[model samples]
Target: MNYKVDPGLYALGHPDADSPVFISANFKMSFDHLRTSLNDGRSGWILVLDTDGINVWCAAGKGTFGTEELAKRIESSGLAGVVKHRTVIVPQLGAPGVSAREVQKRSGFKVVYGPVRAADLPDFLDAGMKAAPGMRIKTFETGERMSLVPVEIVHAVKNLVWVLPFVILLSGFSGRGAFLSHALQFGSVSVIGLLTAIAAGCVITPMLLPWLPGRAFSLKGVWPGIVCAALFLFVRDVLWGLHPAGALETFAWVLVIPAVSAYLAMNFTGCSTFTSLSGVKKEMKWAVPAQIAAVALGAVLWVTSIFV
Candidate 1:
């Protein structure tokens, strides 16, 4: 979706020099949210910062919404001439990147942090720019967590398009029945295993995030991966009446599924409010290599199972 707006000053509803100046990221969604919140007969000047189309929270973590950008945008946009008040209200989520003192020292404007949610902006402004305790708190409710699932599913499907065919082709090399027959039998099972891992990572893990055991996302995801693996084995060995897989193939999948799920779950850190930039970096340093090693070893074991 195209969600970028130009970075500059935008006037909302014929703002005057006495109107308040609000700071925001140039993302279309961020700008729209701010404007919509102020539509209740309030007038203001929105100074949109260049954040490369990212929303405020993420942009702040990446440093795109930092003090330098805010100061530069204020100067370049001639904000001092447009507003009589020297104060600019920045969203609370953008606080990570911005230093209020630094911005004031550089741009000659005082920075006032607004509420965590734009929906509360009207009340915050009417209450003499004071944020209630509730407005300062950020929550990752069920709806917010589930909203990120579709993006993960889309990414999994894209990767599967190529990996699935390769897996099926390799299945034909098993020294058993006719090539096509072996491919259909073994490859179908492999596909099911892959789908189960995807569901565990992209859906089940996120759905059970809060209750999942561990603060680290990778560790939390392992529980769901284990559950999905058991379910897949049940369907394959009992319900489908397919030939039971060899010990090597079964063991390989046990390692591979959890690793895949953990990696995908770790990616969710970027989309969630529960993690910080530093924390994510620390997690990836150990988690990524471990995941790679697990998947590689699993692949070798699976290939060896075919001939033996």
Candidate 2:
């Protein structure tokens, strides 16, 4: 579904020309957040810029919530005629894309950066448009990190769906009869390994982000992948006495799980406040190739184990 609002100026609670004008991305969630934060009987004008349904921080990074868009939106929306004040409040997260000097130079409107979050807008407005130090600092707390997990899991599952069938079919390759039995035996262990990788990358990595060993998310994810692999192997071989995998398959999974986990954990770079666009790009350049190589090697070893 389309999750974007129309890009234009919207009035809230009978706002007049003198009311404060808040800048927002056209993503419905971003627009809604800004509007809801001002729901305490405060009237204002929201100028929504086209961000292609992306939130303020991401849109800013992508250059959609930028100076050119801000200037064009101001002119197109007839904002100057509607509002007497020459000031517009942009969200602090969007500061990366919007150059205040360039915006003012182009549109003749001063850009006042709002708080890091929309929830702080009321206090910022009440303080005569001055933000407290705490309001400016962006935080990536545990709750926010946890909130991003479900989407990651959804994406991981989507990728796994196409890959799982091929893996299951491969597990049955014994060059003999009884394909179903072999598939059930070896395939179940492979499925466990894949699921463990998903949990390591999508859940454990994000939850233990602060305490994780490395700065790069992919590297940080390795610890969880290793721990999950060890635990899964232990439960299967020792606790359950269900050692269906041979030596090669066991070693293959130990390599594959961490590689998959690292790749999946790298996806969280977009959702994290700790990484910059350049940093993400740099990490991906090396990490993607490494993850691919590891997974390919592991897959070869796993398939070879079935025949040998």
Candidate 3:
């Protein structure tokens, strides 16, 4: 969805020249949330910077919410005329890309980082823009993580499309009956197993992140992925009254499912509030190579399962 507003200054509830100015991305949801949260009883001037329809945290990480964008927006929005104060409140999460000192030097307006959540804006502004200790602390509460599930699912499903054709071709070779007779059935089961593995990583792992055993999402995701793979095999055995493929097929599942799940789980680091940019980079260095190795080996195993 293209949720974006024109990049400029917006007045919330008849904001006057003396009203506080808040900096935010042009994503409509981010803009709406900030305005709605602050609309309780106070008036404010909102300076929306173009982040190409992305949320503040992501845009900030992507550099769209950097010093240049904020400085340019401040100038283009005519914020000087709209607000009397020289300081603008920026979201705390946006600090990674934006240098407060640089913004000040360029825009001649001081940047003050506000609370992490927009809901805390009322208290923050009411207290003369002094953020409480709790406001500065970043949190990824259950609801916030849950809200991200849909987008993750969509991204994962897009990548899974490539697996479909491979799945159909591979499973057909492993089937016992005439190729055409069992290809569809075997392909269907493989797809189910693949999707289950993905869900175990994308949905189950993220939902139970706090309780999951490991700090590394890849490790945490592997456990559920293994369980999902096992269950798929068990279900096929029980329903079809036949051994699903052979040792090679089981070996392939052992590698592929967890590998896929680990990869999907790793993607969550980008969405997390706790993981540092440098930490994510370091983790990816080792984790990506391992995941690639496992996936490549598993694909080879699956292809060879029919002949060997």
Candidate 4:
């Protein structure tokens, strides 16, 4: 649980009292990146704060990397005694939780907001500790979005453990054909469809957010889900060696697959760079209700289709 580093001052290289000090959260990855960025003979001091292993931006938002913690760390680390200068550079993302004036008042250390990206730290520091406009911007590029895919997949798998089994058991209750064989047939189809939907929402849509055709994360996710549904339907005959899905099966997938996908995609807002707190709330106000309706309708149709 403690995915954090020791909270204190760490030296990038041997330095005198004149060396510059930078502030960061104690997340190992964040600490590592900060240290790695400073590896090119740019000697400095890094003052780490306990953020429970979360990145600076997230920790700041959560208040773990805020004013009080920063002030406390400054006092506890004996930073006053280590340096001649009193200025400490902090990531701009932490501005939400840290008041520059308050940190200075308590710790006698002036706080300068650094660039938004840690990779820009060298340039930021070299430019007399001034951050360029570009350095302050947060862009949700493809690579950034793709970075969250592993976590998304892990969440999906946890749910699928129970969901897939439930689908298999329910499919056995279908009125047509031998129960076990029918379950196997329906379950296989369900598994592929569900997994496709999850990937569409959680992986594909996020990676292609800008081009996916909607402002809402839920809507963006649906585009991929629809495509996956169609592909699954088209290949059903060849893949399953069974007859094509009937009207109900097709309708069910069309509704539920994208609905579930949308739900999961919307949940990604917490990790997304593009979304705002208000925007997500407004989107969910209308979207959650609609998604629930779609999933419910799909379930009803699927059940009725078994006997019909």
Q: How many clashing pairs in candidate 2? A: 0
For each candidate in turn, the TM-score is: 0.90, 0.92, 0.90, 0.96
Q: What's the CA error at residue 65 for candidate 4, in Å?
A: 0.5
* Residue 142 shift from truth in candidate 3, angstroms: 2.2
Root-mean-square deviation per candidate: 2.3, 2.2, 2.3, 1.5
lDDT of 2 by residue, 1-308 (tens): 99999999999999998999999999999999998999999999999999998999989989999999999999999999999989999999999999999999999999999999999999999999999999999999999999999999999999998888887898798547689976876677678789999999999999999999989999998899999988887777764355455788778888889999999889988878778879999988999999999999998998898889
Once fitted onto the true fold, the runs of candidate 3 whose alpha carbons sit more than 4 angstroms away are none
Model 1 reaches what TM-score against the true structure?
0.90
Error of 4 at 135 (Å): 0.8
Candidate 4 per-residue C-alpha lDDT over 180-209 given as tens digits, one digit per residue, 9 for 90 to 100: 987998777778888888888888888888
What clash pairs does model 1 have? Answer: none
Arranged by lDDT with the best first, the candidates are 1, 2, 4, 3
Q: lDDT score, residue 49, model 1? A: 97
The total number of steric clashes, by the backbone 3 Å criterion, in model 3 comes to 0
Model 3 worst lDDT window (10 residues): 174-183
* Whole-model lDDT per candidate: 0.91, 0.90, 0.85, 0.87
In candidate 2, position 190 carries an lDDT of 72
**Which regions of candidate 2 are displaced past 4 Å?**
174-177, 237-241, 281-286
